[model samples]
Target chain A: MSIPADLKYTKSHEWVRLEADGSVSVGISHHAQELLGDMVFVENPTVGRKLVAGEECAVVESVKAASDVYSPIAGEVVAANGDLEGAPETLNQDSYAAWMFKLKPANAADLDGLMDATAYAAHVASEAH
Target chain B: MLKQTPLNAKHHEANAKLVDFSGWEMPIHYGSQVEEHHFVRNDAGMFDVSHMLPVDIKGEGARAFLRKLVANNIDKLQTTGRALYTCMLHEGGGVVDDLIIYFMSESWFRLVVNAGCADKDLAWMEVQRDKLAPKLSITPRRDLAMIAIQGPNAAAKLWAAMPGTRELAEAMKPFHAVVVGEMFVARTGYTGEDGFEVMVPNKAAPFFWQALLEAGVKPCGLGARDTLRLEAGMNLYGQDMDEGVTPFDSGLAWTVDMSGERDFIGKDALSRLPRNRQLVGLKLLDRGVLRGHQSVFTAQGEGEITSGSFSPTLNGSIALARVPVGIKVGDTVEVDIRGKRMKAAVVKYPFVRNGKALV
Candidate 1:
């Protein structure tokens, strides 16, 4: 799957979409969910929780193992996807569509530090070999 | 640098996600592991299990050698083609390996052991054979390849692949083996499904695997195999019990024969040891997945999960935990998943069988 050119990505495989209201929607990248096959349980960051950049804020458990979903930037979680509690497979179907949480960025400049679609796509390809 | 099975090329052709399992390069999944798992439970799926070693024992001392070698009594193997599940143990009562012993003849028996423990098991067996049954021959058949076709529809699929072999396979009881041409087919599997574990010559394996695939048998992998076996309440050799743990604590005491007059390798040590912990099944009451080495908190005492997975059939996390012996079925315990303690119910296992949930 091609990386969405519009979204920013983290090295840990989390993707962040800058929203119109300055809050950012965060979810795992398509490649991340593909690597971790069959999501069984997903625990999103609780709303109102303050998360530092690179903080392990959420968890995604697949049939094989559980992995932490790190926060891509310093932020406070404003909302979380409640649908994931009962339907975790949505992430498997379309990871970008199934956003885990929305965060209000503490510093908007932090978004520029993340990899662009080209750099992220290159990183993913490099890891494959 | 990794060992390749006979079906290695076939797995690559199928675009399987190959992973380094122990020292062998084996497929972890073909596509979606969940889909592969569901295929095994609902229809049919096949796994390349050639990495596991098959040792053929022959001689007049074969039975006597095995009688003193394993915890389960070889005396129970009365008929030809019958199979017995047993644990080979160290002198300290710790499990050397868990294996399936097939009574092929009075003087000929076959033992299939875990791939990772093959060398260790053979070395241990050779020691016993040298000491007590010097005449017995233990041969590890690396020339053979094994494939497990499992699920409710497995028999029909196998028959489709190997025409006219249906009657032979269907006639054999569970845990029974039959030789059809060059293939040694056993009505046995690690998955808790009606299936066959066929051992064929390494040269013929890729062809047979392709034939089965053409017969509509989905190619499963080690990922599905783990979930299926965990649901079946089967113990994984290295994770569930190893050289440091006894069979009594691994939910294999029934396979151990204490009532008989047989004197097995670890009988003396086992008889004297007091049982403190016992293996039990756990169904997650909370959301997170249970995994190996996770701490278990029971009223009786703290314990640990030996083999745990997200059960596809049950749609929940399940585990085989070694807890205080006092814990019984229906008792609720807490499993420490990372930092949080999650509720899990202790239950009798073989959690799912024949496409149905038991617990």
Candidate 2:
């Protein structure tokens, strides 16, 4: 239930962090990884690939089921976390630390359109029922 | 509201993630499904299988009625307490449901059917009972609750959990049930491990579950159960086959009894119809996990995967598929997994047995 106020989130459960280099790192949220429970495989979008907002650019498969990781905003994938290829369960250990991929935003202003910690927390609550 | 088992509270207390399975609110996993699967293979684990119903058939013509109702011959049970794994078929050769019949006496017998098909099975049994043996009593034992404790050390843990009942079950053989007071303990399990499927009254389930937990038996959910059963090469009732397919093509032909003159339901259809499909196991050589409903490509023709999962015991993906009859073991098949055709090898099933890999 740790929603770091520093990062932003999408309704589909991907969290985005604006790094010091102006690039954004994206990964599934703690809630998403918790629901998935025990990751078995992680497939990141190809590096240097263009992505549209809300596009399914990655995948996170757990022992229970597979889930699509949607891109929060339009961007070009700069780096895919090759580390996850060997250890996908690192997300279960620490989701925020295990970023799936990083992107160079198409429009940095689009970050404002995404939900903050409070809004995303409410979005997660709305789904419980 | 979905149905809840007597041990539902226990599952919640153990911090289980609950899911709606076949109209019943059951636990899919306690915490980690893969970890639970391994624990059951290495040690002892227990499952609350109360959703599955038991039917007690009692009367002078009980055995005679069952002989006509199911596909496999019940005449093979020469002694009391023996259990036979078989399928109940419709008027045609299609499987109505797969069940285990336990012979308690000449006039008394018990059957355990899948949870999802309990109502339909009960209705079918009643219809057949009225026509064949009006003097028979077909009773659904919903009052009883069942729990399966399994693993290599399952017996020792069970003996430690409940005292005094050990001596009654100590000398029991596999596929046999010994009733002690109100508890019916069977030396059979869905997992390939050695253990007992103990059935007791609903009120006593909580106590037994607690005792077993205190004895260090880890609580497992359906998630682990599915993987374990898949590894053991056991067929699920709905996912594997239904009223549209018979046991002949569902890897259950050995369970069908055309060996004797015993006339049963769907016997003529089984004899007359041509079985051009066969169920075989698949070992994935690709990266992704194999799952159900995926299309399979074979040298003979097209096929479909019935059940598939990542086998925790083998640390690889395996599946059961229904393919054209010509497919043989060691043959290669490609499975369409998320639109990607991955190479998989066709092999004999029961991929893992007795806590060891066979494929």
Candidate 3:
């Protein structure tokens, strides 16, 4: 339910935050984590790997089911959260703060193409039915 | 609209995440499923299992009727409040459903059957009653609600929440039940942990649930229940075995009483059928989650995982699979997970019990 004003989100619930280095840190949205429930394993995309927008790049598994994490924008993965391998529940605790991977956007303008906070909130609201 | 249980409002008030289970609107979790699973394993947790149906059989022919209907010998239930877990099967030896029958008296018995299989089971039971024991009367008790309190501290929590229950249930061993007023407290649970499955009047369900909550028993949902039962090596009626399979193939041969000379519903067909595939436990040697219907490749032949999950108790993935009869404990098998063959070891099931991992 907490959709930060600064972060952009994908329809699939991935959140993108523009970091200080111009590289954007990406993770699943708070709503995504809530729906998935208590993540037990997070398979983060490898660093230095190139990804296309909307590609299934990683997996986040919960006790109930396994879900594919899609890339919000095309980019080269700069860093993967190694901490997730040992403690995946951190994502469930604070999804916005626990970034899954850092990406150097292939086209920085692609960030604007994703849904903003208002749009993402509406998208989530529409899904409830 | 999905069917709702008597405690549906109580679950919503607890902020449960509701999901469509079979035809019923049931809670999948109240919060973190892993935490709920741990609560039931370590402390105490309660589940609103009112979706299941309770049927009562009464008359002089009640005992005689069940003996011919189920695969397991019901005559073994000699003492009052003694329960028997058995599979009701078809003439072809396929499982109709698995149920728990409690011997309340010489002429009266209680049966708790799965929610999904209730209607079909009733119809099947009626058919058998008309053909065999026409004198018995079977009545479905829809006015009752069921709650399962599980874990190491489950009994203490129950005693504290409902006063005087300790006196009635303290000495009750596993598979035994005691009637305290209108509540039927059975020392039985799907989870490997010690607990009781209490049945009470539908109107009192909310009050009982609130009392348990105040007693420090956490509210768990079906998600944790499935994981706990899976780790305990319990067979789920539809997932682990169904109308397509018999008890011998579902890791439930021990529950089937074929040793007796008495004939049961599926006895004749089970005797003639060849036991080719058998259920075995799987411990993932490598990373990844094992899910139901996933293909399994043994040294002898191919098979399928009946029920699989990430076991919270063991902190690893485990599964129950039906593989070729040649596969044994300590053998290695490859599971086709998302098109990749992942290495897994075949081990004796109950991967976890009493907060300890056996494999």
- Return the lDDT, model 1, position B235: 87
lDDT per residue for candidate 1 within A11-118, as digits (tens), equals 999999999999999999999998999899999888899999999999999998899999999999999999998999999999999999999999999999999999
- Misplaced by over 4 Å in model 3 are none
Question: DockQ, in order, for the candidates?
Answer: 0.93, 0.68, 0.82
Docking tier of model 3: it is: high
Which candidate achieves the best lDDT against the true structure?
1
Q: What is the C-alpha lDDT of each candidate?
A: 0.93, 0.92, 0.93
Tens-place lDDT per residue, model 3, B10-68, is 99999999999979999999987888999999999999999999999999978888888
CAPRI rating of model 2: medium
Candidate 1 CAPRI assessment class: high
TM-scores, all models, native as reference: 0.98, 0.98, 0.98
Sorted by lDDT (best first), the order is 1, 3, 2
Q: lDDT by residue for model 1 over B33-109, one digit each (tens)? A: 98999999999999999999999999997898898999999999999999999999999999999999999998999
TM-score of model 3 vs. true structure: 0.98
Look at candidate 1 and tell me the lDDT of residue B247: 91
- Candidate order by DockQ, decreasing, is 1, 3, 2
Please list the residue runs of candidate 2 whose C-alpha ends up more than 4 Å from where it truly belongs after superposition: none
- Relative to the unseen true structure, what is the C-alpha lDDT of residue B49 in candidate 2, on a scale of 0 to 100? 95
Q: What is the lDDT of residue B54 in candidate 2?
A: 94
